[model samples]
Target: MARVDRGAADVITSDGHHLAQYAAPLRRATVDDPVALPCVGDWAALTRLPEGRYELDAILPRRTAFVRGGVGRDSRGGLSGDSRGQVLAANVDVVFVAEPALHGSDFADLGRVERLLALAWESGARPVVLITKSDLVGEHLAGLLDDVAAAAPGVDLHAVCSVTGEGVEVVRNHLGGSRTAVILGASGAGKSTLVNALAGEEVMETQQVRASDGRGRHTTVHRELIPLSGGGLVIDTPGIRRVGLYEMSRGVDLVFADIEELAEECRFSDCAHESEPGCAVLEALESGELPERRLESWRKLQREAAWMARRTDARLQSEETRKWKVIHKSMRGRGRP
Candidate 1:
């Protein structure tokens, strides 16, 4: 589907035709689970009914689905419980991690960049770092780029100024025909501005960030796919505040490869990198090789990802057990002893 609203979607077909399609009864019933619902980048199977209606029957298997853990009610339907992943975008080839250049030239949030990179890596898509509003921090741009580069490993990083049209084409080159990209960032990150600039038109709404706090209003509240003039597609998503990890250990390791490499050289196989003797990670910290803050960020993400994995496993196990119980009860009832 091109875009998914509350229950409806705008589906684009092979012939470049678009239509508003609503979910069929069965699919609607499954909408409560975000995984089962049709997302903006999903390719869905639609059925045409006699009364001029289009039914989104099913979503095709996605090559890649970008998801993040979101808080939801539990079995008891209480106010708080374990979080589950909400699908962000499907079948994406690249994720552009946008961080706006701060006013008065404050340092960009590399910690958030690390977090976003981990999530992006977990999405099974290549990630590119875009420092939006590059013109704001022109003189101070080089140092900021170096800082972000250290945080992001093996990722293409760029400084893009949407209003001034700097580095915009380089960004667009990533989204050619058949390749899809999603812009991910927090509010006031100049994501909407970048999107509009890339589309070469005012396709997405733009808002000015507050000069005091350097935060932009939530202009793009929902995820929507916009087809570019050059043939590829781009999905614009709302600014994400908290980026909770969902089973991304390898991603974490990849993002922090410097620390990972150091960990492998530790004297003990299970060194916690604290006060352990012959700890390579600790050595790096003490020698100023690895910043303490980065190490802390890595550890925090690792723990959160592990916790999310455990919760996911438990939830699936409970669901499976419940299904078996219901099946056994039905079988026993039919026996009529």
Candidate 2:
């Protein structure tokens, strides 16, 4: 439920304890009125009707929001190029990155995992790396889990097979009530399978992946916020194979904490770690302390994030100009000139 007006509520809890499922008309206010309304997960005062219906009065403020940058449309139905990050959800606590498992022969793809880790870290939520199909990999699983841990420092990592229920209990224990988590990964990454195991029901659909290609078919098509039977909420988004780093500079540093720490000891305070004198990051590589591949990945993500930030900022500035122009035009349309 949430605050609506002087003493009214814009939303209330449904009998299902889900989002308020009803949309009521303004009793005193008429049509064509602007909406300054409440959103999901808001607390509202309610007036119960004899028919067992309820009315929302107001929307309480939100604690936090999960957002991503997106483009806006213009009058011609084309993208204005001006973009802004749209809020995906609010009050999320954990970001579950369900990734594909690597059997003995091939190493699990670390690049993609790093990107997801950066995204999760940037979301201001705890990131838990859930590696699926550990049972299939047999004894070689330990090395793969270690690789993931090395890729993402200071994050909880788990390997589970939905079929065998391996490590499922550990994953469930992390989702304490009142805390929310968002699941992100590629198609066929076993996100739905994990969610089903956590929810203790088959709420989401799942598909079998192609053995030859190592890719799974898409089962979930929409971004839905599902309530776990235990207590907290889990937002299951569609299979996201590609996650573009829009503006996650701070997140990059956090994800590559070791490299960042090494750079701090460089001779120059602003050392770029690229052919620079007295570069500690490079020294670590030569001394076998840091792998060259890890440093390269760090540089790639940093560059991409920086570039994306520039593009997004440019789009935002253009959008702000357009909004002001429209407002000025509306003002002139109302004046006698």
TM-score (all chains, Cα) for each model: 0.93, 0.78
lDDT of each: 0.85, 0.72
Scored by lDDT, the top model is: 1
Residue 55: error of model 2 in Å? 9.6
- Candidate 1: regions farther than 4 A off: 15-33, 73-81, 104-106
Candidate 1's displacement at residue 191, Å, is: 0.8
lDDT of 1 by residue, 65-99 (tens): 78887776668876442556778999999999999
Cα lDDT over the full model 2: 0.72
Residue lDDT tens for model 2, 1-337 = 3212333333425554422323354433322212223423344455566777565543345564444544557999986433345444445688888887854465577888888888777767788998887777777888889888988988899998987788888887787867777787889888888889888899889988888887887888755667788877776777875566646757788889999899999999999999999999999999989988799999999887777788877866886999899988998999934
User: In each prediction, how many residue pairs overlap at the backbone (N, C-alpha, C within less than 3 A)?
Assistant: 1, 19
